[model samples]
Target: MVDGALFAGPALRRLRRREGLSQSAMAARLAISPSYLNLIERNQRPVSARVIVQVADQFDFDPRLLREDETIGGVDGLARRLSDERFADLAIDRDELNEFLAAAPHAAAAFARLYDNAAPAALRDDPIIAVRREIERWRNHFADLDTAAEALADELRLSRGDTGAALTERLRERHQIAVRILPNDVLPDTLRRLDLHARQLQLNEMLDPASRTFQVAIQIAALEFRSAIANLAAAPQFADPSARGLFERHLTAYVAAALVMPYGRFLRACEGTGYDLAVLGRRFGVGFEQLAHRLTTLQRVGQRGLPFFMARIDRAGQVSKRYAGASGAAWLDGDASCPLWLAHRAFERTGELCVHPVLVDGAGGAPAHWLTMARTVNGRGGARFVVALGVEAHMAADIAAARGISLRAEDATRIGQGCARCHVPNCVQRSLPPHGAVLQFPALEQGVTPFRFGG
Candidate 1:
C-alpha cells in the first residue's frame, strides 16, 4: 500500500492520462467510484492501499513511480526563485507552496517558467556577473544532468581507478576521439581542449591524475551526453549565448564529477569515512576542491548524503563559486562576502584546518550559525584559492570536522550575511551601510568602523 504522505497525485494523473483512460473509465476498471478517483487524481483525496493495489495489478504499473517526491525539487527551485530581491515583497509560506506544487505541478512549473522569462536576469548590472550567476545556478544542481551522469556511471562501471583509461577507451571506441597529453608549452594554461576536425583531445601535462581523468570525463560527457546537457541548458531559458555556453561547460564539469565520483559510490564513501575530504579525494583520485564541490551535490532522493555548503574564494576575497546543499540556505546573495569568512583567512595561512563559527544574520534575534572548515587550493596561473566546506551549527555535531568544536552560542564569531544586509554596528570591515538603515557620521564621535549605522 502506498503511503498517503508519498502519494504523487500529479504523477498518477499523468500516468492515467498516458494510458488513455478517463477518470470514469479508470475508476470503473479499478472498481472504485468515479468521484473518488477524480478526487484522488486531483490530490484532494488520498489514494488508498486498495486503490494502489488495483492500479498496479490491473495496469501493470510501477507503484513506486506514483510515490516519488519529485515535486520537492520543483518546490525548492520555486522557493529559491521567489527569494530573489525582485520578489522581496512576496508573503508566501512554505506549506502553501508545497501544496500548490503537489496538486498542480505542471502549473507550478509553468509559473516558474514565466518568472524565468519575465524576472530580471540575475546580476543584470554586470554581464560577467550575470553569466557567473547563471553558470553557478546550474553548477549548484541540475536534476536531469545529474541523473543522466549517475546512470552513465552505473552503465560504464566507473570506479576510482583508471578513470582516464576508461574514458579514453570510451572516447576512442564510441566517439572516435583520440586523447593526447600535450606539453606545458603547447597547452599553456588550458586543462583540456578538443580538436573536432583532428578527432583529438589535448590535455595539459601539469594537471594531476585526477584532474586529467576529470578533464577526459568532461570531454566524453560533452560528446556523449551532448543532448542531455543541452536540454538542461535550455531549461534555464538563458537570454545570453555566453551564459548558455558557460552552462554547457559547467554541465560537462558536473558530468565529469559524476564520472569520477559516481554519485552513489562517492556518497557511500563519504558516509563511511565521516566525509573526510582528503581521504575521499585520495580514494576517488580527485582534488580537495573537487571533492568539496561534489560534496554539495549529494541531493539525490532516497540515496542522499550530508548537506554541505561549499564555496571557493580567491585571495582578493572575490567569491568565484558557491553551492548550498539540501540545507536550502542562500549563502550568497550578490553582496560582498563578509571579509571575516574563513575562506578568506585560509589564503593567509595555507593548509591549516580552521573551524570558525559564523552567524549568518548577526545578533539580536534567533541567530543562525554555521561551522565551516577552510583550506587553500592551487589554481591556474599560480594563483591560490580557498575552498570551504560547512554545515549548520545544529548539524555540526554530525560532521567529523566539527567534532570537538565549540558549539556554545558565544563561541560563534559575530558576523552578518553581507555588508548591505549586515547589522553589525561596529564592524571595522564595513565597506557599506546596511540597506534602508540610516547612516550616522558623527563629526565628534568616532568608532572602529568607518561609518556608524543608526538604530
Candidate 2:
C-alpha cells in the first residue's frame, strides 16, 4: 500500500491539514510554485534543509520527523544487501543518495537496510539509533523520579515550579558545570551532555535577554524537572526508543516554559499586562514565540486562565505551530492556514507591528471577537519567527487600547482565503460560507460566493 511517492505523503498532508489550508493556498503561502510543492508532496522532488527549518521555526514543527527515513518497507534493507563497491561504478553520488532519502523515504530506508546487511562484517547497527535507544530507557526512570518530586513543588509556592532556577543552583554548587551561553552555533544543539562526567550546557549567547534566559532555564529544566516531564511523556506510544528519547527532549523544552512562566505568574501577567504579548514576553523573561506557546496551556481547570490561542510563521508564510485550547481547534488540525488571515502580514512589514481583529462563532452559533498582534523576529537563522498573539473578543477593546491593537476586530484590508472558508455569514472576508453554512441569501445575487448551505 505504501508507494515511493506516498512514502511521507501522509505526514506532508497532515502538515497541510494542520495549517487549515488547501494545497494551493499552502503553496502560495510558502511562496513556492504550487507545482513545486506538489512535486515534493508527491515525492517527485526532495525538500531542502532550508524548507525543513522554515517549517520548524515557523510552525514549530519537528524537522527531524520530516527528514526521518522510513523504518518500515524501505529499500534500505535491499541497499544494505549490496556492497558499496558494487554500486561504485553506477556513478550515483552520495549527495544524490541523500536527495533520494529526502524525496523517497521508503526507498531510501530499504536501500540503507540492504546496504548495511551487505556492508563489511564488523559494521551493521546504526550508532545514532543505538545510543538514542539507551537514552529512551533512562527517560522512563525520570517518570518515577518526578512522582516523588511533585508534592515538594506544591509546598514551596514554587507555583512557578522553579525547576531551572533550582537546577542552576544545584549544578553550580554541587557539580560546577559553569553554565555558559555562546551562540547556538558555538554550542552543541543537544541540551546537556557529560564530557568526562562533567556536565556542559551550551546555548545561543546572541539570544535576546529573554530568549537567553529561557535557554538557561531550559537547561536547568532538563536537570531539575526531567522527572515531571518524563512522567507525562512516557506514555506508551512511541515504538522506537530513539523516537521516545526525542519525544522526552521536546517535553524538556515544554517544562522549561512552564517553569519560567509558572502558569500562575503568567495568568496574572496577562491580566496585569492586559494580555499584551510583548509585555508578557518581557515580564516572564520568555521570548515572543515562547510566550505565545505557553498561552495555549493555560487550561488547567479551577486553576485555569484564558485559553488564548497562538501560532508562528515566517516571511514565506509557512506556519510553525497553531494551538488553541478553547475549541481544541488546532491549526495543525486544519482550521486556518490562509495567507490573507492578517497573519501573513507580519512577514511583509518585518519589524513593523500589525494587529488583526477576528470574530469567532462557535457551534452554538454565537459570535465572539478577538484582537490579534503580529510581527517578525530573527534568531539563530535570518528572520526566524513570525509571531502572532490573540486574546478573547470581550477583552479586545481594553486590550487593544493598552497594547495599541485594532479596536474594530473586523475591519482590516482582509483578502483571500482564510476568513472566506469560514461558515459564518455576514463575515466581510467570507468569499464563501463553509460547506454546511445556512444559506441566508434570498435570490440569485445575494449570495456572492459559492457555498451556501443551511445545515
Candidate 3:
C-alpha cells in the first residue's frame, strides 16, 4: 500500500532509536532500562503507543507518525529492495544506503518515484494527485515569503492586512503612481514591466479596484524586485521547465504583494491596525482575499507574524489555495472535509461579521488552529469562494471590523451558485468538484446538498 523500503531505511531507524541520548546513555534519557530500549530497537518488541508517545514527547519526535513503528513502518533491508526492483538481487550495500538516507531523506522518495514509473498513464489521468505535489511545492516556496512579511508586520505592530495596504499606499505616495486593472484578455497570466515614466503599464484595465491594485503592485514588483523574486524561485526543486514557470508565476504574484506591502514597513502597520481587512484593502487598493493571502506569506524566521495559514474553499470542499507558513502544519490530504466550511449564515445578514472557529488536524494528526472568517463575496454572477485563515488569536481584535462583510456573502459561502458544489453526502448543486476534491460516491447516492461531484 505504501513504499516498502521506507520502513527499512537504517538512518531513519537509527534516528528513531537515538531518543536524544547516546546509545550507551539511552536508559538515563528515557528513565527506562537501556537493555529494554535495546530490545525494542533490535526488533525484539513491537513499539507500543506508550513508547511512541514517550519518544515523541520526550525527544520531540512527531509521535503520531507511524513510520518508525514496525507496526506502522520500519526500514528493513528486504523492504528497500522490494520497493526498488532495479536493485532487487543486485546486492545492495546496506551501509551505503543508510548513509544516503540519513543525510538526504527526501532523495529517498521511493514510493512516489516507483508509482510514477510503474504507471505513466495513471499519472497523466489523475491530475488531482499529480497536481497535488506541484501545488504544495508552489505553496511552500510562496510560504517562505512569510518570514520577511512577518518581520515587517511585527515591526509595524499592525495587522498584516493593514501592513499590506499601508505599504501599498506608501509605495504609491513615494513613487507617485496610479493603480489600474484590465480584463484577463488585456493582461497576461503574470505581471509585466514597461517604462514607469511613460504611464506605460499595459494591463487588463477592466478589472475591479482590488484587481487593479494587484496589477500595479505586480508591475512594481517586476520593476523593483525582479532579481529577488527570481532568486527565490530558482532552486533545486524548481529546476524543471514547467515547474519553474509555475513557480515564477506564483512568485510574481508574491512580489506584487510584497511590493504593495514591503515586509518591514507593512508589518508595522499590521500590528498597528490589528490586521483589519477592509481598511487594509482600502490602503492597498486590493481585496480582502488578497490581503489575507499576503498575511500567510510572512515567513521570515525571527520576524514572524502569529504564524498564520490560509485556505480558500468554495461551496464544495475543493481547496483552491493553501499556504502554510513555517509552522510546518501540513494541509489535509485529498481534500479533507470540514462541516464548518459552510458560511450560509453570513449571507442572510448583509454587512454582519461572524467568526466560526474550527480545528484542522491533518493526516499527521496535529491540531491546526484555524479561525476561519467566512463572509460571502461577489463573483461573476451569484457568489464565489469563502476565504478564511489559520491566524494567530491575538490579532482577532484588529480584524473585528473587517469580518462584517455580508452584502456579498454567498449561501454557505458556496460562491457563484447555491448548489454548484455542495457534495455534503447529497448536495444537489454539485456537478463536479469545484475546488477539486475527487468524488468517491456516484453510484451509492444522489445529490443531497447544493453541489454534487458524481457523474
Candidate 4:
C-alpha cells in the first residue's frame, strides 16, 4: 500500500463527493475527528494506515479499492489525451478536468472514453504530424530558424523596455493593424486573436503583461515574416501541407522569443549568470517557460550555450512536453519519469529550484552524469506543472548550478530509466519489476524491497 505520507487529497475529496456524504458524516463513519478528516480530505494531512483501515471497514470494502478506483482512471485518461499527437508540443492542462469529474462522473467518464478513442488512423496521419516528429527528431533545435530569428532580432533592436512599443508601431505602420485588449467575455477562451477584416489584433485583458507582450510579438512576426516562415516550412523534410503550416506558426513563436531575447545578448547574459533562468526572465521581461524555451534554441553555429534537455510535467507525473538540446539524450516521451527525480519532488514545494546530480541509466550514448534543476509553476485554473532542465556533468561544472556540491559518484543519485526498463534491484521506489526479469519472492523472509528479481 502507498504510505499515508504520500497522501492523495484529491482522491479523498472525490470519494467523499461521490458518496454524497458531508465531511462530518464521513468523519463520524470513519470514527475520526471531523477536523482531522477535513485535513485528510484537503490533503493537508495524509490518511494514515489506521484511517485507511477504518475507512475500509466503515465503507465495507477493501481499502485498496478506494485508491485504485478513485481518480487514477481520470488521470490516466487525461494523460493519454495530453500525449496525443496534436498536443505533443503544447503544455495543456484542462481547466474542467477535475471539476467535471467531481460534478458529473458519468459525463467525465464519457469524455475520457471519447478522448481515448477520438483519434483514428486517418487523424494520426494529419498533415502536421511531421512537424511534431521533426521537433523530436531534431531534439527541438532549428539552426536555420535560429539564425534567421537572430537576424530579425538584431534588426528590430528589441529589448524589455521597448519590445511592446516596437511591435505595436510595426503592427500599425507596416500592416495597418491596431492592437486592442478586450474584456474576458469578448475573447473568453483565447489569449489573443487576429481579425483580418477588422484589421485589429484582439487580446484578452486577463493575460499578464509578459503574456500580452508575447502575443503581440507573435502577431507582428506573423504579419511581417510570412514569406520567411513559409520558405522554412516548405523544406523537403516536411511531407504534409499541415506540417508545413504548423512549422510556420511555430517559427513565428520562435521569432517572438528571439525578438524578446536577442541571441548574442541573451547568450552573454546566460554565460554571465551561469544559466540562471530567473535572472534571464527578469532581464528579458519574459516568463520562466519562455526563457527555458529560448534556452533550447541557443544553438547558433560556433556560439552555443549548454546542451540542455527540458520537460514539463503535471503533478500526477505525466510528461506533457519535452525537448532536448542535442543528440544522445533520452526524454521520457510518454511514460512517467522516475518518481525519485527532483522534478516530482518540486511539486511539494512549488516555485523553488531543486538541484540534483543524477546518473541516468539507458540514456542512449549520452553522458551518464547530469546536473538537473527542477521547479514548479502554477498554470491557469489551479493547474500546477513542474519544469526540469539538465545538462551533462562535464558541461555543468562551469555553470553556477554545480557550485557548493561534491561531484563524486557517491554524492550522485543513481536513477534508472522508467520502471519498465529499470534494472535496479531492491529499490523501495520501484513500481514494477524489470521486464523479462524473473522475481523470486521467498515466503520465509521479506526485505525492505517489495520484490526480489532473479539475475
Best by TM-score: 1
Best-matching candidate per lDDT: 1
Tens digits of lDDT, candidate 1, 290-374: 8887888876656767777777777766677777655545546444578877667777787876789777653233446788888
Displacement of residue 109 (Cα, Å) in model 4 is: 43
Local accuracy of candidate 2 as per-residue lDDT tens digits, 198-290: 455555555566665566656666767766667655663544566567666656765666656665566777777767666776566666778
lDDT of each: 0.73, 0.54, 0.49, 0.69
Model 3 spans with C-alpha error above 4 angstroms: 1-199, 234-240, 327-332, 335-340, 344-353, 361-369, 378-383, 392-455
Instruction: Please state every model's RMSD to the true fold in angstroms.
Output: 5.8, 20.3, 12.4, 24.0
**TM-score of candidate 2 to 2 decimals:** 0.52
What is the lDDT, from 0 to 100, of the residue 15 in candidate 4?
A: 72
**TM-score winner between candidates 2 and 3:** 2
Ranking by lDDT: 1, 4, 2, 3
Give TM per candidate. Answer: 0.75, 0.52, 0.50, 0.67
lDDT per residue (tens digit) for residues 335-370 in model 3: 434544444455554444456554432211123344
- Candidate structures ordered by TM-score, highest first: 1, 4, 2, 3
Q: How far is candidate 3 from the true structure (C-alpha RMSD, Å)?
A: 12.4
TM-score for predicted model 4 compared with the true structure: 0.67
Q: Which segments of candidate 1 are over 4 A away from where they belong? A: 1-122, 125-139, 362-365, 441-444
| TM-score, prediction 3 | 0.50
Superposed model 4: Cα runs more than 4 Å off:
1-130, 236-246, 363-367
